[model samples]
Target: MRLLILGGTVFLGRAVARLARASGHHVTCAARGVSGEPVAGARFVQVDRDHPAGLSALDGERFDAVVDVTRRPSHARHAVAALADRVGHWSYVSTCSVYADNATPGQRADTAKLTVPAPVEVDNPVGEHADFYGPCKVSCEDAVRDGVGPERAFICRAGLIVGPEDPSDRFPYWVARLARGGEVLAPGTPDDRVQLVDVDDLAQWLLYAAENGLAGTFDGMSAALSRSRFLAEVAAGVGRPDPELTWVEQDFLLARDVRPWTGERSLPLWLPLPEYGGFLARDVTDSLAAGLRIRPIAQTAARTLEWIRASPGDVKAGGLEPAQEAEVLREWAARQ
Candidate 1:
């Protein structure tokens, strides 16, 4: 199989290229070449997707499959316009954030209501316009499906993707914290739900869809797990199975100004309950049934820790510093 990845220098795209190469598929990665380097085995084509003619370098090229992981609607539209006719299968990596109702759990991709697509003027979503991220993806999904038609388009609505080479701090924070081994400050209740897909697992599924010509929309993540199990598996994976975890109430944490998800003074992957109950607890039964294989969290955690150790400077830093955690824990204990 001949595979072409549109943005192959970064996380998920790189994973897909690497896996495709290893699977004996001839892989070609087309990118701006500024983010990161593509895997050693795949062919690299330096092309800018920001302009309409940027992809003209590959004028007569064709591929068995093309995987595009672009947040910009313009990029998606340009790729589809340039290569939709020649590519055998088109896979667009989208996010679960496109769903309009995040408070309701167990919503399937086919039945869920999607947010409004970005307006025609908004090309890039950044900083103050961050909320446009999901909507832009919706526009991108629309372009792919409309360009290639549903029979040849695979739309993957991915959840929180975590594993080795992850550019986010959400999952890696737990791996590093657990490896430290001490009185760790855990957020929310132990029963709070969590969901994520390993990068390799997601990449494999994308390849499977391309190889088998699977079409239609589906969430891309593992089955949801309790927060306690999530942390325990991570700890065990990092060789700290018995760390002391102090589960703090959500109200207390929020009152103390501790942020949720990723960022400074934040507990990564810890979102406020009820409001975001469905965000991390998506029903991926259809995804699983459609060849999305999920490995154990322990395995994902251990591999992530190894990657962090090898590339310490590459991991993005945005979690509770030890002192902030200690201070929050101290406050919580006092309230208790």
Candidate 2:
């Protein structure tokens, strides 16, 4: 089968391109080659979908399956317009963020309401992390569905895709931090739910879906696990005994101005809002039934740690700094 991966230089895109190549599919990765190089064994096409030249480069190309991991709705619309006529199946790697309700756990793909839709022609100039990310994805999904119709369109609403080569430090932060072997500051309840899909696993499943002609939306994530269990699994993957964890209350962290999810002072993989209670606990029953398989959490953690060790400089930007964590712990202890 001939495969085309849009934005195939980093993380999920790289995973799919490399895996598809190994599986004997003739693969082509189209990207600007700025973030990272395309996976080896796949043909490379330099196309910045934001520019007219990028769209022109794909004018004569054709493929059996096209996996688009674009964040910008405008880019998604452009790619659809360029390749819809030639491609056999269109797979858009969307996010769980597209859902309107993070408060409700176990909502199916069709049952959940989506966020505000963005205009297909409007580019997210503020960048991928802007507040418009989810809303724009709603539009992006629509663009693909509208372009190719539901029969040939595949939409994967993914959640917290983690594993080696992950650019986002959300899960990697815990893998590296807990590996240091100390009293780590944990956030929220011990039994708070968490779920993530390994990038390689997601990649494989995506290719499988496209190959099998499975169309329509599905939640691409694993079943939820307790937060404490998640941390312990990370420790085990790091080849260490369970490290001491100082479970901090959500209110305490909130009062001290500690943020959730990303940034330097934030605790990764935690959200205190009732609205987000189900963010990490999204239902993947349909995904799993449709051949979405997740690897063991420990294996994902170990591989992520291996990547961090290999690239120490890239590992420093995520999670709370040591001094900041210690300060928060000290204040918590004083209050006690």
Candidate 3:
């Protein structure tokens, strides 16, 4: 099958491109031309998605399907329209956050709350209207359903996506923190529900959806594990004792002032109010139906540690090895 994967330089997008190529599909990747060099067999097309050049450059190219991962609702509403009449099937990468009510635990994909309606005016930015980014993604899902009706559209709503090449440093922090003997901060209750899809599983299901001609919103969740058990594996991976971890109350965490995030809100770097509401609570039974599988938690931790050790020179470096992080923790103890 011929395929086009938008944005394959990092994270899930990169995994998709590699998997597609290995499966003997003709694959091409389009991006903003910032990161990642071209893959050996696949073609790399770089065009700013907003600029006329980005959309116009692909005027002549054709594919059976286009995986719209890089798109926000504003950009996707326009981009998918270009392919609505041409592409065989359109799969939009969406977040599970699109669910109207995420604070509640154990909501299935089929739940009424999961499907957010498209806004009356999609042209306006959606993020501004939604209380959190979840609603913003809801608007994006609406655009895709608009372009290609439910029968031909695939909404791959992912839970927390973590694995190799994790650029954001969100999950990696917990992994590395436990690896080095440090006082770990438990953001919320250890048993608080958390779900994540490994990058490999995400790519596999995405390609399967495009190939099978199947279309529906699939909640892609690979594993459901508590925070305490998750980090314990990381500690074991690096040959460390299950180091001490202080389970801080959620309200206490919110009360303590922390650094600002990006150009937006100011709160705990990890538990910002808007983000905390969504991530602090999530359940993804629907994603399991989509064939999302995870390596054992212990295995996931071991591999993450392995990747960190192998890629020490990487800019996103520092996951335990070198003894530096451990030394810092020791100094903090001395000061305490």
TM-score of each: 0.99, 0.96, 0.79
Full candidate order by TM-score, most accurate first:
1, 2, 3
Off by over 4 Å in 1: none
Q: State how far residue 239 of model 3 sits from its true place (Å).
A: 4.1
lDDT of 3 at 135: 54
Q: What is the C-alpha lDDT of each candidate?
A: 0.93, 0.87, 0.66
Please give the lDDT score at residue 212 for candidate 1: 99
Cα deviation at 222, candidate 3, in Å, is 3.0
Best by lDDT: 1
Per residue, candidate 2 scores C-alpha lDDT tens digits across 225-288 of 9998999888898887678999889999999988899877889888886869879887788889
Q: What does the lDDT come to for candidate 2?
A: 0.87
Regions of candidate 3 where Cα sits further than 4 Å from its true position: 112-132, 239-241, 251-281, 312-336
Q: How many residue pairs clash in each candidate?
A: 0, 0, 1
Of 2 and 3, the candidate ranking higher by lDDT: 2
Candidate 1, residues 217-320: lDDT per residue as tens digits?
A: 99999999999999999999999987799999999999889999998989999998899999999888899999999999999999999999999999999999
Task: Return the TM-score for candidate 2, rounded to 2 decimals.
Answer: 0.96
User: What residue runs in model 2 are displaced by over 4 Å at the alpha carbon?
Assistant: 119-121, 125-129
